[model samples]
Target chain A: MPTMQPLMLPPLVIETQNLTKAFGQQKALDGVNLQVVPGAIGLLGPNGAGKSTLIKCLLQLQPITSGSARLLGREVGSEGREIRKRVGYTPEQDCHIPGMVGCEYVTYCAQLCGLPFQAARQRAHEMLDFVGMGQERYRKIESYSTGMRQRLKLAQAMVHDPEIIFLDEPTNGLDPKGQAQILDLVNSLWKRYGITVVLSSHLLHDVDRICEQIIIIARGRVLVHDTLENLKARRRGAAEVVLSGRHQEFESACLRRNWACEPLPNGHIKVEHHSDSLNSLLGLLDEIKLPPLEIIPSPNALEETFVQALEISHATA
Target chain B: MPLHDTSYQHWEGVHLGLWRRRWVIARAGLRACLQGKWMRHLIVLCWVSALGMTTVLFLVGQLLVANSIVVKWMGNFNPALQAFAGMLTTWLEQHPEISVRTTQDVLFYYFCIGLMRAGIFALGMAIPLLITRDLASNAIIIYSSKAVSRGDYLLGKFITAFVLIFLTWLGPVCAAWFVGNLLAPDWRFFWHSRVAVAHVLVFGAASMTVLSLLALGVSAISSKEKSTAAVWFMWWIFGGVLAPIAVQTQPWLRHLSFNFDLDQLALAVFRPAHDLTIAQTNIPILGDMLRGVRPQTLASLATPELQGAVAALLVMLALAAFLIRNRVRPE
Candidate 1:
């Protein structure tokens, strides 16, 4: 093993101080401040919410407009080369060198990460194996299917066995099974391989299942940044019941029972759980004889938290 | 559990220096270029050209020596000897003023120019495969995402295309020089020809650097491979073949052609060492003979001035560098 340089492997994965990026009059990253640690972090945002821009800024792939940023304790632009040595980035687009076979392309990427030729080739093969790619590795990347290309991108990103990897929409255009397989590999990157991952996407289901930390950005500003557990724990006693358009009776019953309820847009009623247990809502459901079709309890849901964060950001704007 | 207790992976290998990574880019580029059928065929053609070119130099070196073995061999009455002699005589046919007193330095200049004519094709084929394909495929993201910098990427690509162009010309020139020197009469022959070899090196470096970068610049600006190839070929072919037609009228229009400018530079580089007398002028008499124009003296050719050649090439090189610098970044 090579001697580990402390500067190369800092404890904090990313630290940005009021980092801003602008194109002419419009700012893509509006004075964003963040300190990311090692974990499976989901960067969630709606379309055009600066998720990709933030990743690009953090990697120094684009010039910052103002302020400063660092990766693994090194300054963003000045030390970008060193920072990239310990980091991997799988871009949201299909990026493969033309006229190269899958294995050769991966080997080239490993070499670019500073491995010697033989070592790079061996590492590339090992990474491809780890990503569950097989004989298809010998084929040209131009001929690869979407799933195969995604796997190739993943393999190339992990070729050097980076400490952290930024996956930008890694599951885009993949079938459900392929998406599941990729997510499984991504989960393993953090679990079995112990590599930090920053998964940037708008898909809440994917994030909810794989990410421990969530950073939600909307309109170029961070709406929320906290642990998924903490965000979910912040939820109050609440239950959203599918009342099947019979909100008036449920509203009357909830009013008599001293429980506040809001009728949702999708024909559901969100009831504030004042009772110590869910049996209160259950007992009320039995008394009203309006028997709900489905009841969803909060205080452990990411969807509610995600929606609330987006709503607050929208309201602020 | 955020992956059941987050920890750094165990493989904490040392990152090599930045130069090594740049070399990696260059090495990969060279491998990719060589994969093309045109590149492979061009390499084989260069080899064949080198063999043919050096064989002439070998005979010339033998001629420069006293008591030459080939001259002695030609005296044989064997049927094979007569046929070989006939071929040599036909090839060695030259003007009365040029045949007996040709110097090695002037010959080296012609040799360099000859190989360059072939090299234009090599450049046309190899350069499009470099930056154009990368841009077309959107692989700039792949490179930018790595530890390699934008400068490193361009330099790596420059080296790859430069080597391809060099192999097609300078590499063969060096081979011809070495083979010729090895057949020389003695150490004095090597000393006598040192100036010519130096001229070839200087000429080779200048031309290859300018042409390779110019082709790369064309590649950088355009994303489509076929259009890039077309643009490069048109620039060289039109400039080389058609520009000479206008040279008869304007004469100075030779500056518009990179090949003409480089050839003029080649003449200047060899001028100091040429052994031609004031009564004679350097002329590839057969070139004019084939063109159906009666052979004329160098004084009548009206070539582009050396200073103009130098300035034009410098401007061209700057433009190429600027294009590559701007377009090498991720879009």
Candidate 2:
């Protein structure tokens, strides 16, 4: 038995150095150099943007054609076994060992991570409970619905209590309520449990709901990776404000505050919301007594960011 | 934004490492294979056939004992065993080790044959159950993403099928050996037949390893469960039908086309010091009564030599190893 070594995890959960994965002439992950800190990270990319490929490469499920990567401070390929022990991954496709029930499957996965059988069983049930699986947990995975299977996949991934969980398209094929339920559960992993969650999806709304960090990939390259606040802040001067007072007064008030405010034809002032937060703008309104009737931050700011990132990446390519 | 604490929390719990973890896959694989109705039935059927074959061999072994009564009774029919028994008893009394070896070799030969036949069906079922099913469900991703390396996964899968294959042969072979020794004239029977089990242990280990490799290789390359089964079944049918016909045209076909090679291996491993009269016919009065060519069991004189068969099997092992190694890649 190898003696357990105390972990010295790096500040970055994932760090890739010029990582490139190619199939013959086509590169799936082209010169991807990234340093990902731990948090709820949304990996957003178009179809064939190498989101799945990147996840697989980081997990070492797929061998990297070249370059290098590290997960949780352990070098990939060399320390893959130890890395895998602490990381949980679910690919986009549905997968389960046939004939095993949900609990058994999860327990089996836990055992594979080197947990003893009894502990594995206990942890399996714990994860199943955490995933909100009910009596149907006893049912074979083959008979599970898409939502149930998705939940089961998450349960199995977490059964080992991994430090990092990578979920690719986890919310794919779920209804709105099911999606919210899964998203809430996933949110808790990052929020309450503090497990690093790397959620890869095309659903901008899903990412916008929970992710603190956003990575947008296009043309097999990362166009942008920044804090969600920073990404949304890029759409500066897009916040709309409606005041109960006169429009001229608000415009004068905004001018006095030196905020980048634009008056649209619809009688609303667009303020840049300095520092990417509306709290300061509201404080200014309170001080000026230009009582605001409404404050509408750009709801599509992340969407625009995602689109513009892809466009820029394509343009550069 | 606050950066993470960056303190990796290694588990302080009991954890099984590489050496202890593979059994999980093997156990799960076994559960799945045994859960299938047809798989269970096929194993049961194999055991039943083996039991019957063992019973026949036991009865035949007894009839060959160098005693006077049976031979005296059959004297009028031929008087061959009576004279043969006189020389056999004299030779056996001088070199009793041959008698012991003869007893062990015949039973060991039948055990290998039964095991190979049963293993073919088990492989047909097992490849689909263990290998392609994992592929079809994309369970490979789940496994590959876990702590399991390709070698661990392959070993786990091999153990599952090998266990089933040996179970089909070992149980009946031991039963025959035990019962034969029980009814033997003295305690020397146990000493004499102790080597019988050795042949089975070595043969079972070697052949099953190759067969397990073949199963995994076929399963890895195939995309669907049905296709995996079809490939194995096709191999069985292809070799079964072709080997006989190929035997006529190509003398070397025995080494490559069919299972004459396996039989050749069995014959080589279990060759007795001297071919007993009863070993030829396996029946008391039949050695003289059947006055004809060699028994069907030994009729493969034109079959290629043992070296040829061994080279063919080695080639097969290499090919299977190549397929499995290439296909089970995480890439």
Candidate 3:
């Protein structure tokens, strides 16, 4: 994960301030503020998390209820056409002209992206090759595999050579190999071209692999938005430290030492401390004369952090 | 970077890119219609059925040698055939030498109907599928490239629909003209009449243009499946086998019919002595129905002329184009 850095400029390609969307009485997005930098950023959320709603408003693909979005320094709805020219989008749902060949389909996209005829054709070929679909370039899209179609979708988004691309669940139905291939393609885009990517996925592992920054949303609100490292760092106190021999006495001592200590179900002392270092915790145990049978450091689990955030946000609501 | 001028130039480039996208769609649609196995079969079937209908009519005519039997069977079996033959023969009696030209002309008229039906149906059936396929396969990634805007995408689709309709009708009309000339050498006399040929061109351009725009309008309003179903259902109901039945049941509605418009307008133009019976009955009644009064002069119906049809077609196309913009939304 990249360290959170302060830049002279905003360092954001996309910014949404107090964004909200409602359908009649039902609110789909509620005061969601997101700032995305000029690289791969993952959008993680469960179903009905307002991820789709956010994407729609950002692209001006649908009308928003309130708030605002800016892409490439222009307001969303007013400058949607201009914003679209600088951004490529691969929708979660397939949009294809069934009988059109891959080559023809890509070329059409290239043209819509403003390449002239000869250039469109050449770019289409190059795009297909980049997606590893060169062999199937002339084959009709209706006959393509799910993975191939996904790749083609990505290719079309990239063919116009947009500065930024939004890939909405690009690996939704792919096998492991296919998913990896898509991930590699996405990674390569950022590395080779410095293209900003906003990848939406429900899979944490996938997001963790490609995204340095992430925005996790739930039920139409931003739950958390920060670098992955910062998110993990927030879970520091949530970590567990186990001491087997200490038992009840060690737990009481740790509680007195200003550590949140609990007697474990396994009859050990489990400690959680945000401010104290590992050495301080060890010194406290030594000062208490509680020699441990076994010592273990629990994993810094993000899943728990995510659930806790959701629970806290929901309870407050 | 110079912001103002360069930004405008970039935007223009994107708009042009959208037009390029439309050309891709048009080419794909044409290729699909021309090559798809089912579409090819459908076209072949239309040609065979039309020729078969003509052959059956000729054979039946040959079988009925006696005038009494022909008259009795015509009155009982098919009223349209009977009325058409009676009108033609009554005209033939006044100008017997011209009967051959009239006969060939009638055949050409029927051939044009079959041609228009086949062309319109085929083109209409394909358009919605094009829209649907794009949505289904997630192929719109190409359309959303930095070069394309939503408005440009809509325009591209409009062009595709218009061109498809044009070519579909053009192909069959040319074929029918060629075949009609070969079957009846007397058709040359009819073609020699500059007025006759001019009328044919006007009618052909008007009716087909109307049908094409209607197809596009339906495509814009509905999804691929719904668009296809709606167009075919309407075609079958309004222009196909049920058309005559509808006319028979509702004589008042006959004036609104495509057949009625063509027949009345043609009579008002030619006014051949042989067509006195039709000129008096079918033509005048249809004219009255359309104009809502007895014909003061044929010049009234003829005044606005085929130009009205052309204008109507252009308007429908523009409306369809506008509707298509709303229909195609971003993800």
Candidate 4:
């Protein structure tokens, strides 16, 4: 019999069991069982990959065809309003009331989340300032730039002081600097304020910058769900070693030493770090009389893994 | 210079109840409506009619009181005071029925007419701005994503429109009443005319509800303010034009006029004894044309006319509610 490990973290903020959602003949989410631990979790997927669908189902904004979901330990459909009271959402689309200044719009949103008028107004100002909106906060939302509008959306999401925030493509239309600022803001929400953030985005770099844990969904299924640190750590010790000369002799020497090696078209040999260390590899190279030019660790293995997961899922589907 | 803290902070404050939260939308909408220069100008213009009606009441009260005072002062009056007293007595005698109609009752009648007109204009100007703009901008999603429910949002919008119509309609009437009371000779007039106040309150509430429902329903279905306003205008014009023609071609269709139904309902609520079958004897301009041709005369007050008015109102209200409910969801 196998024994279970002792629990270390708090209960999950979101838990779904066989969550299925269908639209007519098309299945948007299929038997997705997800347990999201509290903190910053990235929902990574391509368009139409059920990322938004899952979020909507979990939020009770969309009804599931079958199965159940819970948010903050409360069942989704039955306790959606209760869940919404404690959760904030920034949608991917442009959602704004026309003829309203930024401060009033944020205040109105905060009020909609059950904040008192005075408190909502105060928090709206605070949130706008936090999002780097200054005197422009008094300008009509229709007059705001794309970056300003993005910041305003973020500010409204935070104005109610929700425990968890669902940010869908927060950095979607931003410039590089704007994207960096938004990612930093997302990070600070989890780090400084301890707010759980479920950031859904197709941008891997944005997720990589802010998310501690990632959930990659493809074809209505969760392909990968693990910590970024663990995913990156798994690729460690694997390296590509290049030789200036005697490449065939070096490749044969690596195989004779019982090391797995494959020669690339770029004259670099892909070497797996098994029992042998770099010293052993160097010794083997010396025996072949080939000088090592460069030994670079394989980069962006997570990206490769993501691509592999997508490809495998597509092939299986 | 000290750097402003741009860091995220936890909200330590408490939250209000759901209804209070819902009021936030209404308050914001009301503020936005009041902020518009066009809306402000329209409101001012509407109140100007109220002010004119109040001035008429004030003059009527002054004329009534002048007769008694002038009679008492006739024994020791200069030629100017005598001359003024004779003119006032002649005017008082000429319009003796005006005094018979209590100041409150007259004000109520004027208010009902004023409010109906103002309500139409306010609904046309404000509802589109309030609802269609939000729809066009896709702001309903932002609202739905928050703690506010669809029903709460719709109710908040209804309240905003109701309050605006109330201000334009009842606000002026109440002001006129206050002014009339101040200008009256004694508290007897107010005490005797308390029922008119009740009629005003009830009529205002009913009219406001119907108009708000209809405006909001139309607003919900439209994506653009201009489109909503245009549709509402066309609805009125079509109804007005169609109802009269239908009534002229087929007398049975007299009750189909939206304006006719509303007029009958207003009469039933505010002046139940006034028979629409007879030509209206008062009012100088449209009285001759309105006399026998009024749509309500086609059916007796106890028969289909009043029933049709009530039924039409109910059907309109139900239709508006249905449209509003369907369109208020997250898109």
What TM-scores do the predictions have?
0.84, 0.84, 0.66, 0.83
List the candidate numbers ranked by DockQ, top first.
Answer: 4, 2, 1, 3
User: Candidate 1 residues A30-51, lDDT tens each?
Assistant: 9899988889999999999999
Against the correct fold, how does model 4 do in TM-score? Answer: 0.83
Question: TM-score: which candidate is best?
Answer: 1
For candidate 3, give the lDDT of residue B231. Answer: 59
lDDT of 2 by residue, B136-169 (tens): 7888888988888878988899888877776666
Q: Name every residue pair that clashes in candidate 2.
A: A114-B16
Model 1 docking grade: acceptable
DockQ of 4: 0.62
Selected candidate, larger TM-score, 1 vs 3: 1
lDDT string for model 3 (B1-331, tens) is 2222211011124345444556765665567656767666766766565555445334333222224355557668877766665665454445533443443344445555556656666765665655555554444444543444556555555556555545554444444444433443234433533343444466666665555555555655654566565755564457434445654595434333343444444444444323332333444233345444335443443343334334434565677667655555654
- What DockQ do the predictions score, one after another? 0.40, 0.44, 0.22, 0.62
The candidate that wins on lDDT is: 1
What lDDT score goes with residue B121 in model 3? 65
Candidate 2's TM-score on the B chain: 0.77
Candidate 3 positional error at A97, Å? 2.8
Q: On a 0 to 1 DockQ scale, where is model 2?
A: 0.44
Better of 3 and 4 by DockQ: 4
Model 2 RMSD vs true structure: 6.7
**Off by more than 4 A, model 4:** A1-8, A230-298, B62-107, B251-257, B272-304
